[model samples]
Target: MTTTDAVRPTGPGLGAVLSDAELAAVRADFPLLGRTVRGGRPLVYLDSAATSQKPSVVLEAEVDFYEQRNAAVHRGAHQLAEEATEAFEAAREAVAAFVGAGAGEIVWTPGATAAINLVAYAFSNATAGRGGAAAEPFRLVPGDEIVVTAAEHHANLVPWQELCARTGAVLRWFGVTDDGRLDLSNLDEVITERTRVVAFAHVSNVTGAVAPVAELLAAARRVGAYTVLDACQSVPNLPVDLPALGVDFAAFSGHKLLGPTGVGALYGRRELLEAMPPVTTGGSMVEVVTMEATTYAPPPQRFEAGTQMVAQAVGMGVAAQWLGELGMEAVAAHERELAAELVKIAEIPGVRVIGPVDTADRLAVVSFVVDGVHAHDVGQVLDDRGIAVRVGHHCAQPLHRRFGVAATARASASVYTTADEIIAFREALAGVRAFFGVD
Candidate 1:
């Protein structure tokens, strides 16, 4: 696919609920979606919340970057280097626009986990007086509280734990209700004056529950705490506007957004990013350097040190543009239908949904447990029928513990998922207990 072809996918039309024909056409854009698994049974990919499949345009963009114009960005005056830099920066603008952030506020990282680590370590750097006066506000004193939630993936939760360890700050969290919703009835109590940083998932990876962003943000604001959103789930499935949501920082991965792996983004407010100190050092991020000392670059570059994921970033930019053309309203609307269908698995005797059973304020990701049967066994039964799903804690062990379960089998949908596939999943799931002799 050429540059022009990359922008125009033969998928669904913009900003409307996709018809059956439109969904079929959209699924065709993803080559892997058509393939079969486990002895020619048609693939029913329902693990999108774990990672999304890439479309042809995203694949082509990466190939084009390497094949046509591959060079080290922000170096060299030659044509290849200049073009590479342009493509790389253009990708940044595309991603920033997709999430309603400024281009300067978006910094490239290895993944959402690394992006969160960057902020955490940057805060650690500030506590050590790296950025001097400007970094003062970011510094954490002993007994200061850093709040997360009981439903966070390890990527969102562990970094804060490590940061609290490093800075002598206390780690705190909001609990999850029995129905898998965030227990924010005590929001003010959790986000008290001592809270210096408040980080939580925009969507629970295990529960498929959307966090109350407005209320959470307001609570953080009232306490003058920095808000960091782990948008790894929400950004891909829902339309997100970081600026409008007013989070001080947000992180999401490329692979989760129908783009390639090895690239992710950190969205920060312009002023906050500028004030934050660098975590990774050396190479392009530096503005000036001496044998004895070095001064760093601006907000993004200052944080983005060393060689970058140039091709992957380019692919991510194309993906953002492709999804934009498809219209997020349509993508979200389609997934909401899938979410409702997935919930019906609970109707199967001895089967239980671990998350919300209704379609209200959730994505298509659903985790469920089978009575008297292990989650891995349930996954194997589905896999035998050419259905793919995630098994285990889904990286939110605390939430799993809260629910009194060890693990669960998760079926998550994407924009291309079909109602027929959901029917197949439910049929397969209904037989799990029978196969295990637990019916």
Candidate 2:
């Protein structure tokens, strides 16, 4: 068949998922989308997985917090301090509800990477017996194993590697299939009795493939291993329910979910958080402090050391409310339509899609490589046409190695993405090979 014929037909127009009026309203909510670039060409933003554009409501929420309720939380007995503390905890409750978790289960962090490191360091502390009797459940020994997957982002992989290095635990991983799906065929073998933890991504950032959560959870449960989900990609695109998924802990970033940067959340089972040792200890996290010893606060507060990201958390709460109001079902349906159109990039000559060709168990992230052109060159051509895409391993160096490529050009979708924007992406991509003299 000709390359054009290989292209899957585009979905029912963007209107099928979002009506033209709805799309217009959504775009209007995000101020940055209206701007032009590269000498006045309209910007076609397809890099949501890297970081999403904040809506006006999210921006306003942050500014309002700074303007009205600007004070340290859980500190003073003054009115402003009480107000700020109320707002901060309220934001935590809102974020908890968004993930089907309890308010006490959510711990604020700088970002998802920090959250993972927090858990990893807690393990290290437990192994070192620094957390006293309460953290015995997390202690690791030399024979203990930590299971991860080959497709994990570096944030997920590196922390576990460091934890194993510190604790004398072994690190093993599930492999990726040729189609970019997780290879769970030998699940029993990988997650054995010696396994202490199982950490994996809910949705891969590089391949856009959704992991088999139920299967993975079952394996971990069978072996009595703790499960840590990297929900950085899934929480933004899918309806994520941590409690329902039965994961012991999960981490996701606010920025990827239409909130501001420098704020993320770590959702732990309440009991686990109570048992897990605090990685950072300082002011606000303590209940009593003497020069000789210190007593810590409760679960959520204990993990939040020093000054908190009050405004950022408030903005993230608003972002969660905005997505909740829109309804995750509608958002998922809209992105599925975009994914269908995006996979057709494979139809272009010399272009090879690095992930699943269909949109079944995937987000709207499409990564591809030209036969002879470098990924950066491909990104430059797309940028010249006002199409913004991510060009790199996307923090999944091992996954890129699995595909035998150094890097890929990735275009991801968000709620604001339209049918026309995707079409423009495809048109711009079609010219990449020829522009680089590889056509």
Note the Cα lDDT for every prediction shown. 0.91, 0.90
**Tens-digit lDDT track of model 2 for 282-379:** 88888899999888888999899999999999888878877766667778889899999999998998889998988799999999998899999999
- Segments in model 1 whose C-alpha atoms lie over 4 Å from true places: 1-6, 9-15
Top TM-score model: 1
Per-prediction TM-score: 0.98, 0.96
For candidate 1, lDDT tens digit of each residue in 150-258? 9999999899999999999999999988889999999888899999999999999998999999999999999899999999999998889999989999999999999
The 10 consecutive residues of candidate 1 with the worst lDDT sum are 1-10
Q: Assess the local accuracy of residue 100 in candidate 1 as a C-alpha lDDT between 0 and 100.
A: 92
RMSD of each: 1.3, 7.0
